[model samples]
Target: MKINRCIAPLMISVILSVAGCSSSSKEDQVMNANLGAQALYDKARESMANGNFAAAADSLSALDSRFPFGPLSHQVQLDLVYSYYKSGKIDQTLATIDRFIRLNPNHADVDYAFYMRGLTNMEADNNLFQELVGIDTTDRDPSKSKQAFDDFRRLIQQYPDSKYAADARQRMVFIKNRLASYEISIARFYMRREAFIAAANRGRYVLEYYPDSDQLQQALEIMVECYDQLELTELRDNAMKTLKLNFPDSQFIS
Candidate 1:
């Protein structure tokens, strides 16, 4: 019995030693993963700063695989988003932003995340004025501009104290002006097609809904022309009076 007891104690010691080794192995693995992630992160940053966005994306992706939940994982993910954006991979950039927003809605830098998404979409706009001037052959997709403007507006509304809020507000103004101009363009197209009532209504809608728009004067001028073509003399006079009252110096008024 004593020998059995001695063997039992020896067995316990062996088991404990095995358990301790297993625990140490796990800890070592964690440490190695963290180190690997940090090394990859450093390399990725260097590559990005040197304008090697593709290399930076690959390095960061490697870190993601090696240390999926490691300490630098979040930062690597964010950097990956920026790398994809800078590389002009629009779909990947948008997908990464969506992932970040879904995963870390309450994160402190969530505002910046949303801001980055807005900036990405905004930068993709090739200027509505250029499109309007017939310099670009692309079909006008106001939807993209609308998406960017809405995203920026959401950022400003949700994170008013964010550093990007002011810039977002300014971008919103540009977007609004473009939107109003597009409306005026459509109004003019309707007038040219002898759809005078449709053109008059569109112009009136712009003046009413977008009074602060930079295109307000042009919209009012379109309204005056449309109303006169429709023989709505009273409406034409009213539009002229309103345009003169609001923009006496506007070239459209003269």
Candidate 2:
């Protein structure tokens, strides 16, 4: 009723300042609501549900960083593995899976971890030609393929009753057959170069290591051709006879 002008202005300024601070605080909270591990984890799952794999991977990574030993640590890591795979982070997927398998060997979902590991390795990039025609894989690095094969084999042997066992067995067969075919490619390359001895050695490697593969028939033919080119009569005749015995209608027998 009798306020001085100076006092009234000062009071008004104070109220305005307080109101600004409250608004700013609420805004900050809203902006930072996703900083917590639980929030980030939920966001990651939601992103995954929507097929936003890249966002899911980022959120899962944030969750892992924020709560390394939190209640959801194991699940976060496991989810990160899947998110990384779906987002095409092949290296990250493989590394996360290996870490999971090593740290949680007896975990209930260890079989799934192995299966994912195999899938990551199997999906690793190969030579362009190999990716298309599936030849010359042996000429290139076969390390990942071999690793994937072993991973699948281990999963099948260790967890025969696992839900993933059937798929693992099928993948193992595919990898084994591909490996055998790779050997045949190598043998064929050596033959084209007229390196008969080298071709024969490759053929022998396939026959010895992949006896059950479909490429075994081609390996026998390679041995026969290479032995003949090298003028090894005894080896050539033996290979020819084996080829005839195994593939009675083999076109190369004559």
Candidate 3:
């Protein structure tokens, strides 16, 4: 009986040790979590270089969680933004950039963060119908374009000497033109509907807000047409005279 009891205890001990060994390996396989932040970041960069944005994001996110206050935290956030953008996680990208900007407003790379924020909105606001079907649906709401324009404008104003300033300025011009053209389209639509007052107001808005836009002459012509349709002789005549003075050879004047 003593011999049997000793043998039973030995068997139980072996079984427990074996179970512990299995659990350790199983835990490693089940989680597969990286141990070191730097190593994980290096792996993320390697994934990024190979165009594996999904994996790169995963590694970056892991590193971020594990080492939020680490020296590479900001860089990880920036890289994660790029990775999320590449992987089409636009919301995540924007959120990441915004957090970075809020946290590191005076960082050397803050301009880049602002530029990326603008780019994100610009891409989001793209006229997909116009690009894909060659249709000019300019009457759509310009809210996204306005947001992008604000972001780009802030970047330019705050970082005039930044490398991204020139591009931000150019994008602002494009957004302004788009917004002006959209206002014109709305004005013309109102005119077709015989809502002459609304049409005139829209034209005036374009003229006042988008003076430097290419649509300036069109705006003047729209105001002239709407005022004439509404029998506002004085306003119509004033708009016509201004158009003639500013654009003597404009097709809109005719």
Highest lDDT scorer:
3
Q: Which stretches of candidate 2 lie over 4 Å from their true place?
A: 1-33, 126-139
Which parts of model 3 are misplaced by more than 4 Å? Answer: 1-32, 127-130, 252-254
Per-residue error at 117 for model 1, in Å?
Answer: 1.1
Full-model lDDT for every candidate: 0.81, 0.85, 0.88
Better of 1 and 2 by lDDT: 2
Worst 10 residues of 1 by lDDT: 136-145
TM-score to true structure, per model: 0.77, 0.81, 0.83
Stretches of candidate 1 off by over 4 Å are 1-35, 127-139, 249-254
Query: TM-score of predicted model 3?
Result: 0.83
Give the deviation of candidate 3 from the true structure as CA RMSD: 12.7
User: lDDT by residue for model 3 over 56-149, one digit each (tens)?
Assistant: 8978888888899999998999999889888877788899999999899999999999888888887777766688998886777888889989
User: How many residue pairs clash in all the candidates, one count each?
Assistant: 0, 0, 0
Error of 1 at 254 (Å): 7.4
